[model samples]
Target: MAKSPIVFAMANPNPEIRPEQCDGLAAVMATGRSDYPNQINNVLAFPGIFRGALDAHATDITEGMKLAAAIAIAESVSDADLKPEFVVPSVFDRTIVERVAPAVAAAAIKDGVIRKR
Candidate 1:
């Protein structure tokens, strides 16, 4: 499946679903934190991503840049860093965000996804 914002919204408790959704909806929600172990969210992704793009002096974001942001965020927490209710870093973990964003921005530059950087 394609990775995008839809992944996050699908995990919502009351996903704003219309008729004819799909078969994979349950699978998606099953992998969510409310139901599964390593629950992920855009909140877990975006702040650091945009921060990174800005830090790199980039004019825009890109797919490679977003992938970099996600990986960067995941790397901040080790297996040793995980716990129930703490599998992902807290949103208030400014250090994690601050550190992660620049890495993502660097990825954007390295991927040549940003122009006039």
Candidate 2:
């Protein structure tokens, strides 16, 4: 039998499936709504992404920059702290901007997309 799969049914105003319905079937669940435990919000990334772009004077956001931002976000959650209900860091986590911005900026510089460092 397939084990519980991580589900991210992030539909605005209404998620495809409520966290409660998953019960024991889902290993982890996320939604666009803040009422849920794991709320997958775009705010987590955009701030840092823009900050990095501005800091690096990026010409345009590239795939490498996006990947670096993703990696930074993933690294924000330590292995010991990772859990089904805590796959993503809190939206209010102060360190997110600190971590993601530099990572994205560095990636932009590395990918030769930055107009100025």
Give each prediction's root-mean-square deviation over alpha carbons. 7.2, 1.5
* Colliding residue pairs in candidate 1: 52-101
Over 4 Å off in model 2, which ranges?
Answer: none
In candidate 2, how many Å is residue 24 off?
0.7
The model with the greatest lDDT is 2
Off by over 4 Å in 1: 1-10, 15-39, 83-86
TM-score of each: 0.60, 0.94
Best by TM-score: 2
- lDDT of all predictions, in order shown? 0.62, 0.90
lDDT digits (tens) for residues 1-117 of candidate 2: 158888999888989888888989999988988888888898999999999989999999999988998999999999999999899899999899999999999998999988842
Clashes of each: 1, 0
lDDT of model 1 at position 17: 44
lDDT of 1 by residue, 1-117 (tens): 453223333535654542125344433322333443445556767778877877777777787888877777767777886544354565556777776788888887887767672
